[model samples]
Target: MKKSLSLILGLSLCALCVGTSFSQAAATQTVNLAVNSVQKIAITGGVITLTISNGTAGNNTLTPVSDATSTYSITHNSATPLRITANLDAALAAGYQLQIALAPGALMGTSAGTVDISNALAASAVAVVTGIPKGADAGRTITYTFNANASAGILTSTAKTVTLTLTN
Candidate 1:
């Protein structure tokens, strides 16, 4: 009887051990992602339509005038700072120069509307502004003035192209 009781106790303990509840802990994991950076610039209303007054019959010159204005927009989505510049693809007529100015309160890449790029050349890029922040669109209007010296030679009613290039 003693041996049988011991066997039964041992069996009961084994069963209890097999039925024991297990302690569990939840596991977690993390994932990370990133987006690519981009920097872009665009110009609208780039065409300059000019209507100049006629020169005096004896004077071979056209008066200086603000011919046209164009708007430039900078869409800076880059992670680094940016700058803007303007240059003319071709030189104006001899003794002539094209003047560019930013609006008084206009916003630039870094400054507030204070830029004048004169006698710009395709080989040289004039700094318009710097420090454009990263984000959406920022716009500025640039006014162009055409100046002609008295010795500019005989004037003709013809189309002259002065390309203004904007660069980052």
Candidate 2:
């Protein structure tokens, strides 16, 4: 009887160990993600000087002077197209004209070439770039032209503020 009881106890313990080894537990979780629209623009150079000191002989019109040393950059992620406009803080004096040109990336937008901003105002801004796509454009050229007719005569050194806007 004692031998038989010991054998039964050993078999029960082995079965318990086998059952525990086959058991398993598990866990789970959820995750989410998202992104937003963004837009930005910047200029790289400052204090460009344009002088009209020379003129063709017997020509009543003074030669126009230009400067293309400045550049602009942009980064945007918008669903729709966009544009860039330019204006001056105040209208230039009569007979003096200031023009601006912007070079867009090959795939970014259409360059308006050069547009005269001499009288452009906040309410009536001039468009310099149009049909801009969603991407980044770096090191784009910006050209400025200054012109004065002979009748306008010599102008004292003056300063003007140019405002460039990126919008839809």
Candidate 3:
């Protein structure tokens, strides 16, 4: 009879120890929702729109970035770089210099968290900020001037409908 009693006590003690161990483990970690991974994609023939005021005009020779070549894209890699180019209509008597630069803030893109430019480009990319570095021609486009082979490494995006916003 004593052996039977001792066996029951031993089993009860084992059960208590297991229950305490499980409860202690559960207290340390917080339960969380499962995380989902995202894949990124790119598009072609993205739109480039300009809304410059006459104020943007300078030297009585404000050269506009031709719609033909005013386009940019992010090439994904360990460090994704941007491909931005532009053209000026006429060369200035002074021999102009045109360059690429990021705009002040995010422009409106059809996609989210972005006003303009691809979110990947925007998130991973940067703005021109008027006085900051990153553009080809700093202030304005010089007539008959051309600047090419400019690149900028931006963050990355995971949305479609990328748009580009450039400024003087």
- The TM-scores of all predictions, comma-separated, are 0.59, 0.80, 0.22
Q: Worst lDDT window (10 residues) for model 1? A: 103-112
Worst 10 residues of 2 by lDDT: 24-33
lDDT of each: 0.60, 0.90, 0.32
Which candidate would rank higher by lDDT, 2 or 3? 2
Off by over 4 Å in 3: 21-78, 87-168
Instruction: Give the alpha carbon lDDT tens digit for every residue of 13-59 in model 3.
Output: 99999999888763466789974432222223344443222223234
Q: Which whole-number lDDT from 0 to 100 does residue 74 have in model 2?
A: 87
Error of 3 at 77 (Å): 7.6
Candidate 1 positional error at 161, Å: 6.1
Tens digits of per-residue lDDT for model 1 on 4-116?
99999999998887667334445798988876776566666756755456666776667667843576665656666676666665555666666666441234355424333
Candidate 3's TM-score: 0.22
Q: Global lDDT for candidate 2?
A: 0.90
Clashes of 3: 23
C-alpha RMSD of candidate 1: 6.7
Q: Measured by TM-score, how close is model 1 to the native structure?
A: 0.59
Top lDDT prediction, candidate number: 2
